[model samples]
Target chain A: DVKVTQSSRYLVKRTGEKVFLECVQDMDHENMFWYRQDPGLGLRLIYFSYDVKMKEKGDIPEGYSVSREKKERFSLILESASTNQTSMYLCASSLKGYEQYFGPGTRLTVT
Target chain B: DQQVKQNSPSLSVQEGRISILNCDYTNSMFDYFLWYKKYPAEGPTFLISISSIKDKNEDGRFTVFLNKSAKHLSLHIVPSQPGDSAVYFCAASDRSGGGADGLTFGKGTHLIIQP
Candidate 1:
């Protein structure tokens, strides 16, 4: 079975702070994705990486960036956290043409 | 532009009954459809998927039916148990949509099973 793990299950940060959310997948899949879920908006893709050091913007990718230093790890970074950034963040990985496996998700509260 | 849409935000059904969740997509180019189930505090899990080549796909008690002309799909859960209660999301991807493109998701439908 594939396992996707996130660094923090819950986090709280004050406004203007920088935050980093980490995700690791055991399967070594080539594709990794970051998404944010908000009420009435479902899961909106923030960023996705198809290879190490390569990233692409999704539908919503403002105030957020990503890094893939290693194939198994993907990180999401918020340059300056704001109250509106509070939401549930999800990480997913998949091989091409396959369904994605998701991590437990990280709930970040920017106060 | 919210290409994918799940009109019903919430649905309530009695346990052991059939729960039908509907989804609609505005883009006809989408060829692959997928359903994901999300529990409280957990990320969405892939439930079942159907390609454009087929109209119906079944797995255990869950089945997905796709209508090409209408640009719609439905997930039917028979004899739904309490564990089946969760949020269901409808997603779609076109043939050209590469892995990096990811899947477009709907707003999601919350299913509640009452015993």
Candidate 2:
């Protein structure tokens, strides 16, 4: 079975602190994505990478950036965490014309 | 604007009964529609999908129906089991650009299976 792993399952950080969320996929998928999910608002895309060293801004890219240094790993970075940035973050990977496989989400809370 | 919308936030059905979850979209350009089931504290799992060219797709007990003219779709589960209690999300995409872009998702509906 394909596996997608996230570095952290739960995290708490102080306001203004820098945060890193890591995602790794073993399927050699060509597409990786980061999304933040909130109650009533659903999942909103933050960023995505289609290839190594390439990234694109999604609908809600503010305060977040991504790095895809390798084909198997993608990282989401929060330059400066804020209270409003706390949410459940999800990582997903997919190949062309295939369904995306997701990692167990990381729930982040900024105090 | 929410391109995909799941108007019902929650639904309850008895075991061995039918459960129907509805979803609507505003974008006519969306040609692919999918449903995902998520358990608490877990990531959403792919359920079933239907393309705009076809109106219905079925996998075992799960059936997905699409109405292109109205931009509406639904997931029907027959003889719903207790394990089926989870949140369901509806997603849509155009996929015309080739590469896996992003999928617009609905808010999701929480389904409760009663015994």
Docking class for model 1 is medium
TM-score of every candidate's chain A: 0.99, 0.98
Clashes of each: 0, 0
Model 1 regions lying over 4 Å from their true place:
B97-99
Candidate topping lDDT: 1
Candidate 2 chain A least-lDDT 10 residues? A93-102
Candidate 2 on A24-92: residue-level lDDT in tens? 999999999999899989888899888999898988999999999999999999999999998999999
TM-score of chain B of each: 0.96, 0.98
lDDT of 2 by residue, B1-115 (tens): 8899999999999999999999999998898888999998999998998888999999999999999888899999998999999999999888788766687889999999999
Let me know the TM-score candidate 2 reaches against the reference structure.
0.98
In model 2, which regions exceed 4 Å deviation? none
In model 2, residue pairs whose N, Cα or C atoms come closer than 3 Å (at least 3 residues apart or on different chains), thus clashing, are: none
lDDT for each residue of candidate 1 in B10-102, tens digit (9 for 90 to 100): 999999999999999999888889999999899899999999999999999999999998999999999899999999999997757665548
Give the Å shift of residue B98 in candidate 1. 3.7
